[model samples]
Every structure is written in structure tokens, then in C-alpha cells.
Target: MECQVKANPQVKEVVWIHDGRPIHSFMATGNVEDSEKGVDSDLNQYQSVLNQRYRYDHHYQQQQGPNHHGSTIIMTNQSLVIQKVHRSHRGRYQCVALNDQVVPGCKANQKHQYGVSKNEQIRIRCEVDAEPTDDLTFRWTLNTSGTETAIEWPSFTIVNKTISIATYRPESSLDYGTLACSAQNKIGIQERPCVYSVVPAGRPDGVRGCAITNHSMNTLLIECLPGDDGGLRQHFNLEVYYGPNESRSSMKVLSEASAQSKSFSSSSSSSIVFDNQGVSAIQHHQQLRLHSNHSSSQPNFLVSSLTPGTTYTLNVYAANAKGRSQTVSLSAMTLASPEKHVARARDSETKLTFFFASEQEASNKSLYIRFLPY
Candidate 1:
């Protein structure tokens, strides 16, 4: 029996299967002299059972010389020469050609965590990247309570030969666990499976590391580090509130000065109000809401039309389908605009000098003087 295979990239190996099992293998080392030595050990046992009556030969042919080719022609032949025909050899035979084999790498197309409610069906997509995409197969498994159960066909559908979507419904607490997907091709099965966690949806975690990144006379740029989404999509909200400075004297003066100004009310439950005696009636300035299907690692909010030299409190909250997270608070003050200054120079002097106060005494501020001849 002879089997021939022709492939690009050069065939790396040839395997002979009999009765749905591998009976012999040959490593196509590309060297004609080493063809006999490439026979794998798997053929030894089979040959012994046949009393060494079978002779195996691997033949490689190159139709044209290396330098004289329009296209290099390569072919491999695996022949099982039987000295005498026997009834035991009457079985199906096949030859498989293999180039470089690649193990499939699978990953969940959706978020790492999936939110599910009881009796709600969710379709999770798994994608695989591998070489030789033909004949690829996928396997899904559900692991719950230390027992892994294999999910058979009809539960999942394959699309475009590389993506598989598995339909799963969580009817009880036991159904909320981990779903893993693995893939295999003619080469081998994937070593690691793509995993996704299923859990009850809830509010997202509060934002962290809130800080005033940029501050001007009329605008404040606030940035915060995002947190987990609690197995759901999350958005961010920023609320700005202004009140008297933390100083007792400052609060008293501002309250009295602004007593005649229009008063504003806030519907936020977490609003902080300050009274006349420096007790923290904060007026809600404005609210900015950002909606995003995917949250970034660091989200920034720009609050404009702010009052200069006034201290304001900013609250950031993350909201999801379930609810909103706890408020993360940050206090920031916009820079005061510079006041006009007039300077007079002496008759004999060619330039006038001016001075400004530095907010922090320990700050390393510099002054530069450039004199141009008139």
C-alpha cells in the first residue's frame, strides 16, 4: 500500500493510520539519505507482530533542481511493502501529511465576566487563532461546584470556522460558574481553554485615585482610575459642588456675602450642604455624565465654567445595569486669575521690575529677566 502527499512549506512528517489508529510515522527530514532512519518507533511493534514481513519505505522526490525551477516541486511517498498478503492486513489505511503544527489559542470575545439573571439566556462567543484553519473543532465545558460537565453539540454554533457561540441559561445558583472553551485541529488540542466567569449582576466598584489633573481659572480636569464593572457594563458620572473654603472665617464671610445670591438645590443623595456658621451648605454646581460601552483604565472629566479661587468638591460614581457604585470624592480649587499691576521705571533705568507671590514657600520657582536695548 502506497500513500502520496504534496504540500507547500515542505511536509514535516507523514503518519499512517490503520483502523482509525496510528500504526506508523515518518519524519520527513528533507534529506533523501536519512529517509530510512526517520521511521518512528510506532512502526516497530506493528512490524514485530507481522514477523517483520512488512518493509516500510519513505520516498521523497523533487521534480526540478534547486536553481532550475519555475516552482519547486516536492512530493512525499509512504509505502508499506508487504512480503505476502495476509488477512490481518485487510483494514482501512490512510496517510496524513503535516507541516508545522500549531496549537489553538482561544479567548472569549466578550468581557471576562458575564452578568446573568435566573432563567436568562446568554450567548458567549469564543474565538480561536491557529494555523491550518480547516477541520477545526471546538469543545465547551461548564465547571460548577468542582464538577466539570462537557457541553455537547446543538448547544453551540460555529461561525466563520473560527468563532463559536455557546448558548447558556442560568436557571439557578449552580448554573452561575465558569464556562471554558477549547479547540482542536488536525495537529493537536489547545493546551489552555478560554474561560469566562458567570455571576449575578451588581453595582460596579467605586472609582479610585481621583485627582485634579488640570486646573485653570474656569475649568478643572479631573481624572480617576476605573474599577471592576461587577460583571456588567459601567458608565461614569461626575458631580461638582461649590461651597465656602474649609476655613471657618472664610466660610462665614462667603455665606454672608452670597446670602442674596440665588440658592440651588441638588437631588443627589450624597450631596454635602453647609450652613452659615462654617458648617459644610454646598450648592450643586453642575453634573456631567459619560456613557460608554467599554470603560477605559483612566477616565477624565472636564468641568468648565467654574468659579476661580473657589474650592469645590467633586464626586465620581460608576453605574451599571444593576445600580451605581459608592461615590468617590475629591476636592479641588481653580487657580485665581492674576490681578493687573502697573509699574513705573526711574528716568535713568531702561526697564521696570515686577514681583509675584509664590503660593508654596518651598516651591522652586524661577524668575527670568531679558533686557533689550531701546
Candidate 2:
């Protein structure tokens, strides 16, 4: 950043100001040295002069355009490019002609903070081209990329050599790179950066789901589209939330099925049958047992016999290469046992007339009757 300021010619001396503060001033005008030599005064001498004569001041705040009427710096260079810069070089700046003795420095430079996305652990970093001894300050901007213009200074920091900031959620992931980090001191300002990205603990996303179905008093088994065709295996983890309370749920690990592993990526559409894969189990009221799958040994669970009268709620979630399906909920209720049948037999000396009583137990189906000698 840089600029040029014209001399007043009548003022005798020239001075630069930023936001009502003095940048620098010179004693009288026409200060250019006509006779200078020695390859522009050795690099070391030039460095010494720059450090002593032009050290920047960090206390001044930036002034918006329409600010202070005119350009402030007297600059001969096209642009002010700082190399290996640090966080101490941030804020609005101006260059003014100080009696033709020095050129103005640069244009205003703004800085931003860096951070991770929401629900994420990754962190961002900052760097600059300054001495380690410079006492740098930091300021961050939030909601920089929203629909509305959210760019703001909001606050600033002054302390040790560096600043580490951890932003809270809702304020963390603002959708774009709008946040600015301003590092300031008496001479200049530099800003560090922050980026936001959320990552779950496991499986890329740590949301685990489940569902129970097909129940008998002894067990409950779930039939899912196979995830692993014998080539792959999976287990069901059940965390039961009982009654009406949600947080009161206890974790119950249902059994796993070890069918032979087969991959869905195999060139066959049938390889994708496990698209119905899900977690399953059998409680004391519902038990899940490994059953023989003559079809393809693709591990499928069996729900065993269950108790009558009790209502059981089963929730099932299915997942595969495509993605996880929504949870499926079901209920099972047991029925009462059937009574045995009794009949009178005909005696050898007496002919007996038989009367039939109607009791429906799968009576829509027919039954066979036979007589044998005692």
C-alpha cells in the first residue's frame, strides 16, 4: 500500500497525519540532497537509516475514505510491498511529502483472523516479516461473508508476542472468508487468520442409529440390506431409551452377524442386496439369534419367540455404500396360547353319534380325521 502527497510550497515544512494523528514531519522544504553517492550508501547504512528514520507508529486507527480531505503520503514508489511480513503491520495508513526529504510509505492494509469450521478441530495459523521483539496486537472481524455487510472491527487486543483465539459456535462458521485479524502496535498492524471446519470423531460423522423389528418373547431380529456380503461384517449397538424419558437410555449391544464377506462393488446388481443393512437385537422380551441363511450366507438375524401381552418398540436404521437410511420403528405384541381338544370314542357294543363343536384356531384350513383299532 502507498500514496503521493503534493507539497504546499508556501508552508515551508511538510507533515503527514492519519485519523487526526501526525505521521511524521520535516524541518522546512526543499530537503532533497543533490549530491549523494557510494552505490546509494551500502545496504547496511540504508537499513540503519530506515530503522531510525521511518519506524511506523501503531497507535493510530484507520480513517475511512472521504477521510481528512486529501492524500497524506509523498511517495516515489509504485507500491509498498513488505516481504516476510508479520502480524504487526495492519490498519489504514497514509503517505505524505515531509519537506521533500522522505517519501510516504504505503496504502492502508486490512487483516483478518483464521479459525476452523464448525464442530471441527483443525486450526489455522499466521505469520509476518518482522522481528520477534515487536509487541504485536490483534483484532478479529466476524460474520464477514453473510448476506449483509458484516465487516467490522468490533474489538482489538494488546499484549504479548502472539494471540491465540478460539471462537465459540454460531459465531465460528460464518460461511466465508470475511473475518479479519488486525495486529497493531505504535508503528504498524498485522493480522492473523482463522478458518472453520467441523469433523466428527469417527466414521467421518459420529451419528449412530438403530431399529428393532420382528419380535417374539425370546428374541427380536432385524433384516437389513446387506452391507458386507460375507466379505464384510457389522454389529448392532442398541442404546435403549425407555418410557417417555429420552436421556435415560442405557446402551445394550445386540449381537453381530458374520455372514461370508461379499462386496457390493462387484459387477453384479445382486451384490447390493444388503442396501437394507441395519442394526438388530433381541431383548429378554426380544432376542436376536444368528440363523442359517441358505440363500447366500449373507448374515441375516432371526427374531426368536416372544412373550405375550407385552408391547415392544423396535427401531431400525439401515446403511450402505450409498448412505444411511432413516430409522424404522415397529412394535410387537404376543398372543395367548391355544387350548387342547377333547373327543368321546365309540364303544364296541354301542354305536355313538358324533357331534362337532366349532372352535376356530386356524379353522379356515381343513384337518384330516382317522380311526384305528384299540
Candidate 1 on 104-186: residue-level lDDT in tens? 77644556678978898889888988666789999988877535664543588999988898888888877788888888887
Per-residue CA lDDT of candidate 2, range 1-374, in tens? 44433433322232333322333233122211211122243444434433443333222235333322222233223223333332323344443332222211211331233233345433323323333325555555555444476455444433345543434333343453444444454444442343322222121111233234455445655554433211112232222212221111221222332142233222332111111123332222223222222121322445445544334444444333223333333333333223211112323435556444655544655667566733
User: lDDT score of model 2?
Assistant: 0.34
Considering summed lDDT, which 10 consecutive residues are worst modelled in model 1?
64-73
What are the per-model C-alpha RMSD values against the true structure?
Answer: 14.3, 24.7
TM-score per candidate, chains pooled:
0.50, 0.23
Which residue pairs show backbone clashes in model 1?
273-280, 273-281, 274-280, 274-281, 274-282, 275-281
The alpha-carbon deviation from the true structure for residue 229 of candidate 1, after best TM-score superposition, in angstroms, is 2.5
The clash number for model 1 is 6
lDDT of 1: 0.61
Give each model's clash number: 6, 83
